[model samples]
Target chain A: MLMIIRLMIAAMFILTTPWSGLAEVQDESALDIQVREIAKTLRCTVCQTENIWESGAPLAQQMRGVVRDRLKLGHSPEDIKEYFLSRYGDYIMMQPPAHGVNWLLWLGPFILLLGGGLLLYKEVIGWVRRTPANPTAPPPPLDEQARQRLERELES
Target chain B: MNKGTQLTLVLVLLGLFYLFYEGLWGNPRHIPTVLIGTDAPMVEGPDVETGEIISLEQFKGKVVLLNFWASWCYECKVEHESVLELHRLFKDNPNFVMLGVNYQDKLPDAQQYLKEYGTTFAHMRDLKGQLAIDYGVYGVPETFVIDQQGKIRYKYVGPVTGHMYTKITQEIIAPLLKGQPVSTAS
Candidate 1:
């Protein structure tokens, strides 16, 4: 009877141990997913091309981990991103800050468009001014020979 | 058209072309460095094990692979083996060095991590992360390849893998050893 009991316990331990490993693996991958999600929103300081999640840089990876740990600790994503911004400055962010010097990064394109529109307007006005007013009267009809030559040129 | 108008039109067209060129061909992959080719920043902190004060200048005259990592970083764990491999690969190569900077980690946690992972290189704690700021480190696991001349030659912003290991050996290390300019991908 004792031997049978020992066998049952051993079986139970074996079954349960694998579950622990599975749980750990699940937790780890869950963490990875969360980190990736957060990293996707944060810019990579080094690459300047993609967010930290998309970047292959070790630093970006590390930052992803930082985000994950912060999430685990219950810090809001905004706070975590803000923490990094405070430390590394707006240049580290893929999206420039909305205030201060980076206000230009946000508003520069619109400003450029306005300037371009003004320039276009000025050029069009200048061209209209320089162009001789369209002749009020139509030109005389060309002779048959001239018309034939023009037709030939068009055909060729 | 007036000369000024014509000139302005040409200039605007040229600017558009330049913008397109930058969008397509600029060094998008290159991480902007506030510290490229600059001397290693001043870092003073306790060594990972000994609690001895360590500074960046101490690693002068050697090629340093300064890695920023944290215990909480998952990718750091993923690339931990690669770091160990690098440490082993260059164990006897005194000219090459690997240093870890524990970014914003508590001492006990950092110690537990070293114990768990097996420390292959000396690490310094970046208590205030001023070192990371100085190095322009935006994220963890950023590796800087400093040449023997003490100038930072390359910066890898992500995980170091077997393929990257081979590439580093061929493109960065071999060329530097041959006294040639480092061929950067950017």
Candidate 2:
């Protein structure tokens, strides 16, 4: 009976170990997903054209750690983002906030595109209007008499 | 296009080009800091050598020079001597305090660096880098001058050496210590 009881206890321990490991992994992955989501939005201050999530720079790593800690602390994603924004200003964000002078950055390209398209369209329309409809009818396709005269002139 | 429209178009294009040029080539170090005149974040960390807690709150009503650096950073090594000298120069002032922040460095390596390069001021280890983020630090070798009222008066990114050393000592810190207003321009 003691041997049977001991075997049962050992079996229970073995069975529970994998379940505990799985639980820990699931918890970590949930936290990791949150960290990645937040880190993706922050620009790596030390690296150009890379967000903190993708940057290998130590600073970016630290920023990711900060995001994870804040998330663990029950701070919302917006709060974490706001914390970074307040610290590093608009530059810290991957997408600059559409306010203040940053409005120019957000809208400048589209405004330029619209204005350029309008100008190009106007110029194209003007060119179409200025062009003769049939290009003077190709100079009346060179009448037979004109063709003969041209040939005679060339021969002379 | 009419003359007025053409002129406007040229002017807009020129403006856009200028902005693009500045964005591409401008020094990231010169990117203006928004922390100026704002309350400095009160932070704390363990001292690198002593393992004792060093809190910035204790230094309230004093001018604090917070220099963030790391062992792996080249510029930090370059400015090490100048940094120590800056501390020596201002250490005599009762109202002046300087603290070194060891950022993103390993414990053994940090201690080894300090042993070789030497440090006069107390350096606190940025354990999880929370201290650095709280201060809005972009990278190592960045310095900040917090006034008596805990307002960050000035911030400079990069090695505080040569002309910068002179500027911080004379133009910024000196004036602030003398109860005179200093320029917040980076």
Candidate 3:
């Protein structure tokens, strides 16, 4: 009877235990989500073109750790980005801030496109003006001898 | 095309060529650092050989030259001798302290490298690379010169040899040691 009671108690304990620990292992915390969001914005300085989140470089991993730590400490994403910017300059950011000389980098291509389009448009219009249209005069009233030869060839 | 249009096209082509040349041939290592003139981050790490904690905080009010190096980096190997020489030159001064930062290298390998190359200064191990990140270091052999007031006055991201060696010793570190302001001209 004691063995049966012990077995029943074990069964009850197993049934009553919460699965929250398993869930915690599977799910990322809110702080982790914040770290991911911030890490995705930073460039891996040691890497050619990878963001810190996607890079497997040790530096990138440390940077992700930094983001997680800062997020845990209540630093906002903007503050974190500013911190990296202050450290590594504009190069650390995946997107260069639109300021000063960076504005030229941002807008130079569009300005070039507009100017090139205008120049091409003007040149095309000039070509149209300079190019002579097809001669519209009636074909010299096709010579009578040529007309008779054409008709004879058609009949043959 | 009209004169104005032709001239504009020529200028645009010239600008594009200049940009292309710069994009292809420019020195990629010359990344401008924002840490210049900013307060140096107080960092600490373990001594590579001794495992004792070495904190930059204790070196406050002294000129600290932090050289980040790794055993595997070729440039670090190239600059090792010059680095030791620089330390020797300034080590006599009570206010000057030079610390080598062992970055992203294995313990045995780092110690072996030191044993092979020889070292005159204490090297702190950046175990998790947090100390390097604190100083905004990305590559090996990067060096920083901190002023007496704890502000980072200069940073160089390559081997310290030849002109760079002379420039750092005479121009940057000497002037700062003398309590004169150094130019931020990289």
Candidate 4:
């Protein structure tokens, strides 16, 4: 009976230790996933065309780690992003900020759209104003000098 | 119109034209990039050789140079020399560390490429693309320079050469080494 009890206790410890270790590893991996999600939105400065998440560049990888560390330290996502922005400038963001000098990056297209709409409106109004109301009104007689000039131009 | 009035009008028009030109051609200096100075994202993956789990947190308090690359990317291959150079330069500098993230390439291919290039830097295989996504990587050959404080200080988006290395070192690394706050702009 004593031997059986000791054997059972040893078995339990052996089984539970690995399980606990596995759980801790899983937790760490989960935290990594969370950090990765936040890093994906940032652009890599070295490869301006690629985001930090996609590039295999060394710097991107380091920055991803840095972001993770900051997250672990209890910094909010926004704080992490702002911290990078202050050091690297707007080029580091995949999407440029809308404030300060970068507002144009966000608003330039809308401004162009409005300007285009206004120009189209003006053109349509000018066309309407130039059109005569009555289609069948006899055409105003041309002055003799104007008629002569038109005839000469057409002939040439 | 009098000459003075004509001159004034001309000057105003010129000024307006200049403003538009600047708007089109000039990006504002020191406009903060969204990711600049931000905390780096956590990235973890299997070690390229050992298949052991590697986490970014392991290298805390060291200046890290994270490089993203691939076996098939031509620009990455072009920049490989500079990467090797940087490694050689900083190999003895305990405060500096460089990590290579293999983006979307087979493990064998990446290992072979690195072998051919003679790189001694440590690398992680981001086989499932999870690590890459965390860094917001759009393509390979991007680099991020993180300071000892773990803030991302510099980013280089394309193939880097010797000239780029010098410029970045002078503008970013040298300042940090001297205990001065780095200027974020070129």
Candidate 5:
């Protein structure tokens, strides 16, 4: 009877015990979600082209860890981004902040396109004005006599 | 194009060319740190030799020189002598304290490094690299000087030797220790 009770107890323990690792991974864990969201926005200082989330560099990995740790400490995502900006300056941002001289970077291309288009338009109008246009009267269709004359010249 | 318009276009072209040149030619190592003149972060870690926990808070009101170094960094080895000399120059001052941050290395390797290259000041082990990140340190052999007000007075990225050593000693640390103004100009 004791053996049967022990067997029942063992079965109950096995069935009821939670798998901590599997639970952490399978469920959309809040911390992992938060880390990914924040990491995706931050440029990896060591690898300038890649964000911390996508980069495999050890520094990037440590940065991801920092993001995770800070999130755990109740820092908002903006606060975390501000933290990095404070450390690495404007260069750290993947998108340069729209401030000061950086305004040129944001708007320079559009301004250039508009300016170039205007310049080209003016130049083309000038060329059209300067050059002679086709005569108003269409040239008479090539006469049979002219065609024959051209053919004779070719033969000669 | 009219004279004014042509001048504007030329100026715009020059500006764009300058930006392109900077993007291509600027040194990747020379990241401008924003922490200068800001409050220095208090860092804590285990003593590299003794394994006892050391906190930067205890060194408040002193001119703290935090040098970040690693076991494998060649520049750290190169600057090691000059770093020691700098410490020796100011170690007698009651207002000055120098802390060595052993960064991103194994415990045994760090202890071996301190053993091989004599260390006079307390060295802290940055186990998870949090301490280095706290100071925005991307590489070894970076140095920072914090003033009595706990603001980061100066930071140098590379090895401190030659003219750099002279500059840090006379122009930076000495002035801060005396509570005089030092230029934080970039």
Candidate 6:
């Protein structure tokens, strides 16, 4: 009867004990965070626009696995990225490489904005220089007869 | 604008137009392979049916034809017969080897696929998809041909049928087997 009672107490304790599984899941390791960070940078080659982190395609999943495996093997994130780049070229990068003609893509918008701003500034300054000191030109210093006619008209 | 500035502007406009043209019309699927002149990845995996290990290392100094396929892929089903035919045409060549890589597939289903489709070559299981990633595979139905020196010479994505079959056999594999430099279009 004592042994049975001890066994029942053990079962209750076991049932009440919390499993660490939930905590384990909630606490994503540094490696997992690194994997997510790297995955976000890689373009899912099969998918047109989605990055590997956002893509549900099998290839994207496989790429993630590759990233994890490489990480475990002591390859740095840059090395892993370089490996992908060597295999798939610049297309594998979410933002294409900034070498060769691709520099234009990076600088094009700012260049256009600066150019447009300069053009507008030049036009505004030119208009300012071309305009007379007073916009109304002081009525050309109204001739005496013209002034008298304007006075008579006003009186009438 | 001065002459130099006008010329620069025209050139810039042309460049922009070219980029737009490439972005809108070029085939996104056609990623210019960086693997084609590089050393083929020395990959190893289990034989899908027999559970035996197979490695690219064992087939050193031979023309290796690696095909990546999955059971769920339809294009693989499309190229099944031609794959067998390609194997048959070149199997007698002592320097030629054909290997199929079962990617992202269950063992039983992959086995069933081989049985259903009729396989003439040994197929290896990609355990964790490392092999596929090592080969830089984007999707299934990709074929790669490695020269005797273990350099990947050609890679093609999609079903290896129709004109592709002829091209592989005649232009790619035939030349490689003869130790002639591959001068034809890949």
State the lDDT of candidate 2 residue by residue for B1-186, as single tens digits. Answer: 787996798678668767756655555566798789999999999999999999999999999999999999999999999999999999999999999999989999999999999988899999888888888887888999999999999999999999999999999899988889998887
Residue-by-residue lDDT tens digits, candidate 6, A89-112? 887888878998778767776666
lDDT of 1 by residue, B79-116 (tens): 89888887887767767777899987888999999899
User: Where does candidate 3 clash, by residue pair?
Assistant: none
Clashing residue pairs in candidate 1 (N, C-alpha, C atoms within 3 angstroms) = A46-B31, A56-B158, A57-B157, A57-B158, A58-B141, A58-B157, A58-B158, A59-B140, A59-B141, A59-B142
Off by over 4 Å in 3: A1-16, A26-29, A126-132, A135-156, B1-6, B9-28
| Candidate 4 deviant stretches above 4 angstroms | A1-117, A133-156, B1-33, B50-54
Per DockQ, the best of the predicted structures is 2
Tell me the deviation in Å of residue B152 in model 1: 1.0
Candidate 6 residues lying further than 4 Å off, grouped into runs, are A1-28, A107-156, B1-27
Residue B78 in candidate 3 has what lDDT?
Answer: 94
Which should have the higher DockQ, number 1 or number 4?
A: 4
Clashing pairs in 2: none
The local lDDT score (0 to 100) that residue B49 gets in candidate 3 is: 87
Error of 1 at A35 (Å): 32
lDDT of 5 by residue, B60-84 (tens): 9999999999998999999999999
The sequence of per-residue lDDT tens digits that candidate 4 reaches over residues B1-186 is: 455754665565555556556544444322334556778776788877778887888877887889998999999989888888878877787777889998878999988887787778789898765565555554677788888777878777678787777866667666665657876653
What are the per-candidate TM-scores when only chain A is compared? 0.62, 0.77, 0.63, 0.61, 0.62, 0.56
Model 1, runs deviating above 4 Å: A1-108, A115-156, B1-30
Judge the docking of candidate 4 as incorrect, acceptable, medium or high.
incorrect
Please identify which of the two predictions, 2 or 3, would achieve the higher TM-score against the true structure: 3
Model 1 CAPRI rating: incorrect
Position B44, candidate 3: lDDT: 90
Put down candidate 6 lDDT per residue, B1-186, tens digits, no spaces: 465865676576666667656654555557567788899999999999999999999999999999999999999999999999999999999999999999999999999999988888899999887898788888888999999999999999999999999889999999999999884345
**Model 3, A18-134: lDDT tens per residue?**
565656755557667788888989988888768999999999999998888787788889999998998888878877799987676577677778777778888899999987676
lDDT for A31 (candidate 2): 94
TM-score of each: 0.51, 0.81, 0.83, 0.55, 0.79, 0.74
